[model samples]
Target: MAQVYLHTMFGNGARAMQEAAGSRASYARMEANAGAADMLTDREADFIAARDSFYMASVSEDGWPYVQHRGGPAGFLRRIGDNRIGFADYRGNRQYLSAANLAADDRVSLFLMDYPNRRRLKLIGHAHGSDDPATIAALMTPGYGAEPERAFLIDVVGFDWNCPQHITPRFTQKEIERLTAPLVDELDRLRARIAELEG
Candidate 1:
C-alpha cells in the first residue's frame, strides 16, 4: 500500500509461485524500493487521457471475477485528484453487472492498454457508482452519442506499468488513417500527374 503495486496484487499463492520460480527475492526488493505507487503523476494522467478503452475487473458476491470492457472517446477516463479517477458509465445493456458487483465489493482492478505503443498500465482501486449530477457531469463527454447513466469513481490504491511482451500492435481506424495519410497524398498526386499528361 505504501509504495508497491504487488502489495495489493500478489497474495500468498502468488508469492509462493514466485518463490518456486526463484524470483521472490527480486520482487521483494522491488516492493521495498518502489516509489509512491498509489498516487497518479502527470505521466499517468497523460497515459489515462490518451486511452479510449480499458478493462475493469470486479468480484461478484458469489466470488466469481468479472472483467468488462469500458470505452469511450479518448480521455473519458480522467484523473480527478491525485489518487482518484472517474468515468461516466455510458448506457449499455440493462444488466448492471459492474454496478452490482461494486455494491458488494468496492475493490476493482483495471487494465489500461496502448496496443499501438505496446504499453500497459495495471491498477488496483476501490470504486463506487454515483448518480450525482455533478459527479456525472465531471466525467461526461459532451456531444458523444452514448447517454451516460451514472459515474464510477475509483480511488487508486496501487498502479504499475506492465511489460509489453506478447502484445500485438494494433491501430484504431483513426490511427490507421493518420499513419497512411502520406501514402494517400502521394497517390492523389500521381493521379493528378497522369491526368495532366493525358490532356
Candidate 2:
C-alpha cells in the first residue's frame, strides 16, 4: 500500500541509492504489504479535528516548490468525505502564489504537525479552488476572524504518517496551561497549608 507516496518519492536515482543501501528490498516489501487508502480512518479524522494549522506545498509551472503555512481555529480544515477535505481561503498578504501555482499544477502536499505529541502526517492530493460564495461560506470558520476569499478543496490521493525521529516536543500556550493546571493547584494547596501551620 501507499504506492503513490513511495513511487513519487523514489525516482530512479533515489531507487538506486536505496538499492546500494540495501533498503530497496525492504521498501519493496513494505510497498507490497501496505496499500494506500482513499479515505481517512477514525483516528486520522480525530487527528485532523485537533489540528489548527498545517504546511502546504505547491509547485510552480517552472518546477519550483513553494511552501506556505495555513492556520486558523482548530478544525478549520473541514473533511467533506473520506477522501476529500477543504478550507476557506482567508485573505492574506495577497501574494496568491499558491492559487497561481494551483492554476498551473493541481498537485499539492500537506504536512500537519502535533509538536506536543511529536506526530506528523503527510498528505498528497490534487487541489481545486472555488470562489463560489456558498462554498466559501460553508467552509469558513465561524469565529476565526479572517475574511474568506474563496474555498480550497483537496481530493486526497494518499496519506502517510512519518516517524517522530527528530521532532522537538513543543507546547502551545494553551497546552502549557492545561498541562500545568494540576501543579498550580497543588502549589496553592501547599501555600494554604503553610499559612494554617504558621497560625
Candidate 3:
C-alpha cells in the first residue's frame, strides 16, 4: 500500500515522462495517500521466511550492474529485526564480485520470487559482509550444509509487492510433490482395489 518504493525508483526524468502522459498527478496522489513504514509487516516477514532464494543486484565501480542468485535451504534469509534481514554468505565460485561491489557501494536490491504462487517482492537496502562470529551465528542456519565465510546484513530501506500479471506460474519439485501427494495416494488405493478384484 506504500509508494516509497516507487518514489525512490522514479527520478526526475521518469516523473517528467509520467507527467507528459498525465499520470504524474494520479501517482502523486496515490503516494500521498500511501502509508509507508520503515519496518517490514508481519505478512512480509512470513513471505521472506518462506523464500529459499533471491536475486541480489549490486553495482560495480565501473557502473555496470550485476545480478547474482543466492540460494540455500528455506528460511536461510533470517529477519534479524523489524527492519533488517541477514543471511550467511557461504563460500561460492570465488568470484567475489558482490563483496567487492558492496565495499564500494552498499546500495543493493533484492528480488524474491514465489513462482508457484505468482508472487514477488522487491527489496532495496544497504548490505555489508562481515566475518564477525556473533553476526555469523545470528544469521546462519545450523542444519544448512554450507560453511559460511561471512555474514551478510541487509538494512532494508523499503520493499514492494510486484504485480503478478506476466509472472508465469511455476512449481518447484517440493511444491509439485505437496500438491500431488493426495492424488498419488488415491491412485495407489485404486490399484489395490483392482488387484483384489482380479484375485
Candidate 4:
C-alpha cells in the first residue's frame, strides 16, 4: 500500500519527515516514565468567589482549537457537584466559536485569572450544552436577563493552580496613575483658562 503524507505551514516535506521521526522518539522516552502530576489541588470554595473572567478552549472537528472569554459577577463559576462545574454563557455577537467547537468535541480547557490577587485556575473537563430551565437559571447573571442561547455544564477531570511567579502583579496605584495622568493634566489646564477668563 502507498503511504499517505500530510503537509503543514512549518516547512516542506523534509520537515514533516523529521517531525514524524522526532515525535515517535519523544513518545518512546515519555512512555518510559510516568506522566506529570495531576493539575488540580483542593481549594477553599471562597477562592472562586472573586473571579469574574475565564478563558475557555475547545477543539473543532478538524482538530483546530478555539478559545473564548466569559466574564461576569463573582462566583459566576459554580460547583455543580464534585468534579463538575457550571458557568453562564452570556449572549454575545452571533459568532460562537466555543459553542460550535463544544458541539463537535466535548473536551475543553478553562483558565480563570483573578488579577487583583495574582491568582489563576485551570480546569480540564468534558462540556455539555443545555437549555433546561433549571440549568439556565443556575447560570444566569443579573442584567444579563436569562440564560443565553446555550450554556455549558462541565464534568471537570482536573483542576490546577496556575503559577503566578511569571506574571507581574498589577497594582491599583500604577493603574490609576496611568489612566488618570492625562486627564488630570488636562483638567489643570482647563482650570487655569477659567481663572484667566474670570480675572
Candidate 5:
C-alpha cells in the first residue's frame, strides 16, 4: 500500500513524510518543497552560462499557452539588476508564438537547461519584443548574429534552480547528426529514383 501523509503548510514536505513514516530506513526519499529557503543558489549563474537553448512559454490574448525554443549566443541572458534578467531574441521561423504572446500578455516563463551539466533554470517574468539597435548588438554572437528587426527584451521576476538528477544531456554534435542523418538518407533515395527515371 502507498503511504499517505497530510499536507502541511509549513516545513519541508519530504521531512513531513519521513516523520510520518517513523524514520524508517526502508523508504528511500529526498526533500521536496513549494518554496525552499535556498531554492535559488550560486549554481544558477553557472547553469545559465552553460545552457545553449531554452523553452520560452507565453500566453496568447485568448488565454492560449504557446511555447517555443529560443537559442543563440552563450550569454543571451544578462543580469539587468538583482532578481531581474534580460534575454535577446534572435531571428526564428516565421511563426512568432512568443512574440504574439508577449504582445497580449507580458507574463512569461523560461526553462533553460544545460544538457552536459544536467542543470536547469526556471524563470518567471514579463517580456517585450524589441528592435532596438543596442539590444540586437548585445545579443549577437560570432556566427549567429541577431537581426536588427528581430530581437526582444525580457524582464525577469522569479528565478529558481532545479535539481539535475533526472536530466540527460544531448551534446551539440549529437543534435546536428540526428537532424541531418534522415535528410541525407532521403536525398540519397531521391537521387537513386531520379537516376532510374533518366535511364
Candidate 6:
C-alpha cells in the first residue's frame, strides 16, 4: 500500500507542489487511509523473491543521494523476518560508497523493476551492513560465484507499487530465449522436412 509511502515522502516541499497542482486534498486522504506498511504481505514477498536486481539509494553524509544497482540470482534477496530482508553484498569496485553511507545513516530506498511486465515496486527501509558469516552465508546463493563482503539487511518501513505507464518493455537474454523456443523447434522440424524431401 502507499499509505506509509505517501506519508513518508509527502514533506513540506512535496505538499506545496501538490497544493500548486491542486491534488493535495486527494493525496492527504490517501495518506491517512487505513493500512499498515511495516509488514510484508504475500504479494510483496513473491515480488521481492522474483527480483534478480534492484536499485538501492542511500544518503551521503553531505545529504547527497547515492544510488547503486545491486544484482544477484533471483530470490537471493529473501525475507529474514516478516518485514526484514537482506542480500549478500558482493565485493565491487571497492569504493565502499554505500557501506560508508550506511554507517552514517541507515535510511535507504529501493526500486525493484519487472521490465517485461512494466511493473515497479518502491521501498523505504532502514538498512545496515553485517559481516557475520552466518548472515552472509544465509543470504548467499548456491552455485553463485560472487565473493560476498557482507550482508546488507533492510527493515522495510513502507512500500508502494508504481503505475506501469511509460515503462518500455524489455527482456533479458534468458527471457528472449525462452520466448523464442517454440520458433526454434519449428525451424528444426522444417529443416528436417526439407532434407527428407531432397533425399
The residue ranges of model 4 lying beyond 4 angstroms of the native Cα positions read 1-44, 143-147, 171-199
Give one digit per residue, the lDDT tens place, for model 4 in 1-199: 0011011112456555756777644533433443332322236245655566688899988898888887777778777676677877767787878878888889888887766667777667789989887787777766755447766898766555666777666555656788889999999999999999999
lDDT of each candidate versus the true structure: 0.91, 0.88, 0.89, 0.68, 0.65, 0.92
* All candidates: TM-score: 0.94, 0.93, 0.94, 0.63, 0.60, 0.95
Question: lDDT ranking from best to worst?
Answer: 6, 1, 3, 2, 4, 5
True-vs-predicted CA distance for residue 93, candidate 5, Å: 1.9
Clashing pairs in model 6, backbone N/Cα/C closer than 3 A = none
* C-alpha root-mean-square deviation, each candidate: 1.8, 1.7, 1.6, 9.7, 9.9, 1.3
lDDT of 4: 0.68
What TM-score should be assigned to candidate 4? 0.63
The residue ranges of model 5 lying beyond 4 angstroms of the native Cα positions read 1-43, 174-199
Residue-pair clashes per prediction, in order, are 0, 4, 0, 1, 0, 0
Tens digits of per-residue lDDT for model 6 on 1-199?
4788888887999999999999999988888784667468888899999999999999999999999999989998878899999999998899999999999999999999999999999999999999999999999999999999999999999988999999999999999999999999999999999999999
Model 3 stretches astray by more than 4 angstroms: 33-37
- In model 3, the Cα lDDT at residue 139 comes to 83
Per-residue lDDT of 1-199 in model 1, one digit per residue for the tens? 2356877678899999999999999889777766655678899999999999999999999999999999899999999998899999999997999999999999999999999999999888999999999999988998898889999999998998978899999999999999999999999999999999999
Write the residue-wise lDDT of candidate 2 on 75-158 in tens digits: 998687878889999999999999999999999999999999899988889999999999899998887888989999998887
How well does model 6 score by local distance difference test?
0.92
Q: List the residue pairs that clash in candidate 2.
A: 1-34, 1-35, 2-35, 2-36
Cα lDDT tens digits, model 3, 31-140, are: 77545554698888999999999999999999999999999988998788988999999989999999999999999999999998899999998999989999898788
* Candidate 1 local lDDT, residue 124: 89
In Å, residue 19's CA in model 5 sits off its true spot by 14
**Candidate 5's residue-wise lDDT over 98-127, tens digit each?**
777788888887889877668777777668
Q: Which prediction has more favorable TM-score, 1 or 5?
A: 1
Cα displacement (angstroms), candidate 6, residue 83, comes to 0.5
lDDT of 3 at 162: 85
